[model samples]
Target: MKQSDIFRDNADNCLQLAERAEGKPAYKRYSRMADAWTALATEQDWLDGEIPPVKVRVLQMQDT
Candidate 1:
């Protein structure tokens, strides 16, 4: 959950960067970050019930 939240936060930032790139060299990198965030989310789902609550707490910090 922590990983997912961090990934989600970073993905949001990367998407913003990608939007600004709009024809620049960094576009691909930002796009890839967004994809990585998706992969993280999928992996978290596959993790089933093993995730730690501390991790989730950490992820929540990203929003603050």
Candidate 2:
């Protein structure tokens, strides 16, 4: 299995925890953790070359 897959699995687990959380604080914390894990998975995919890197477009400002 790939590292990204493991990270995704961790994210899923965090979601589950959030679902079972007793209070708003716990739920929010777990949800944020899941987001972080998901981000890591996406970054891993980019590092592994499974997906293309995101391209940024810069716009030039016009002088008024």
Candidate 3:
């Protein structure tokens, strides 16, 4: 959330850099990514994911 907000605020800076042609190819790539990045910035308030570990229990066997 916070990082994305930071990016939002810096968007103009990105466009300006791209406009200034820091490097033609890199500028085009970054410029293209700007929209996707904007989507990511606007898509969610926070990130969520889950990864769980396995567990096992053992018991002594009784004689038959």
Ranking by TM-score: 2, 1, 3
lDDT of model number 2: 0.99
lDDT of 2 by residue, 1-64 (tens): 9999999999999999999999999999999999999999999999999999889999999999
Q: What is the alpha-carbon lDDT of model 1 when measured against the actual structure?
A: 0.77
Better of 1 and 3 by lDDT: 1
For each candidate, the alpha-carbon lDDT, in order, equals 0.77, 0.99, 0.64
1 against 3, candidate with superior TM-score: 1
TM-score (all chains, Cα) for each model: 0.58, 0.87, 0.46
Candidate 1: where are CA atoms >4 Å away?
A: 49-64
Best by lDDT: 2
lDDT accuracy of residue 8 in candidate 3: 68
Q: Where does model 3 exceed 4 Å of error?
A: 1-3, 45-64
Give me the displacement of residue 3 in model 2, in angstroms: 0.3
Which residue pairs overlap in candidate 2's backbone? none
Per-residue lDDT of 9 in model 3: 56
For candidate 3, lDDT tens digit of each residue in 1-64? 4767766656656676678776789798768767666656565334522223336788989999
Which candidate tops TM-score? 2
